[model samples]
Target: MSTANERARMTDLALQEWGVVVGILAERGESWPDTDVTRWGPGVTAAMERTRALCAACSIVGATEAADIGRLADLYEARTRS
Candidate 1:
């Protein structure tokens, strides 16, 4: 569990890392195209959905935990590796 401040910080960090992932994908010719899932495939759609879920969790009180943030970081790493 994390305090509100901690969750806020973690969420910001996760989003920043996600932004880096998106940039890397863009370099590889994968553009997000602003919510147009048809522009990308299911994998990218899943990543974006995860990002949106993180944001949703952060908005609700006590919804986001330390482990959740860690999972997002791990997901980012796995995406980068593959």
Candidate 2:
């Protein structure tokens, strides 16, 4: 049984992995990109649920501290430019 801290860590890791995967996909600029839900729907959904469940365990308090979101936005811009 994972404790709240353990679950939060797992969720963080999962989010990081997803970010990396999305970054790679964005870099490739695929013509027919599959939706994230379709590709890893179950896992993504699970991770999100876990993250929400462990929301209190999250270290970051607000949007201002969300560097990952900024990174994702940059990736989106790069994809559009290419």
Candidate 3:
């Protein structure tokens, strides 16, 4: 668990790491438009729907947890590795 301020900080860290992912993709002469998935078949779209449902239970529109921010950082790392 994390305080709101801590979650905000982690979000910033995750975003900065994602910027590195973008740089790595740019070096390979690829961009988002070139590698877009037609649509998330099931795994991602279903997860997104579930996440939205959980978020709806929160009183805040954009409430977030530290673990969620950490997950974003993990996704950024995976993107750079792939």
Candidate 4:
């Protein structure tokens, strides 16, 4: 079994990873055209909120790994960046 300190450390790392994902998502949202923003903006915002919720709830272990989140952030940046 993991100690409380280890769990806390994992949570912190997960939140940091989520933060990177959120930032990339925000950048992706900013790149959307105004016409399509109406339809897509809410979805992006929801995704951001969900990540924050996951971090707040401290669901790190089997939920999502930091490396996975980093990969996702990288994918978002690559696909959305100009």
RMSD (Cα, Å) for all candidates, in order, is: 8.5, 8.6, 9.1, 9.2
Cα lDDT over the full model 1: 0.59
Question: Per-residue lDDT tens digits of candidate 4, residues 32-77?
Answer: 1232435556656665566556554444443333234444345345
Model 2 worst lDDT window (10 residues): 58-67
Candidate 1 lands at a TM-score of 0.47
Q: Which candidate leads in lDDT? A: 1
Screening candidate 4 with a backbone cut-off below 3 angstroms (N, C-alpha, C), the clashing residue pairs are none
Candidate 2 has an lDDT of 0.44
**Candidate 1 regions with alpha-carbon error over 4 angstroms:** 28-36, 62-82
Please say which candidate is ahead in lDDT: 1 or 4: 1
Q: On residues 1-82, what C-alpha lDDT tens digit does candidate 2 reach at each position? A: 4465654454455345545545555554521235454555454456544534333333343222222434333544455479
Error of 3 at 39 (Å): 21
TM-score ranking from best candidate downward: 1, 3, 4, 2
lDDT of 1 by residue, 1-82 (tens): 6587767675665666467547756766764443445666666666666666665666554534323545555555565589
Q: Show where candidate 2 strays beyond 4 Å.
A: 31-82
Top TM-score hit: 1
Alpha-carbon deviation at 70 in model 4, angstroms: 16
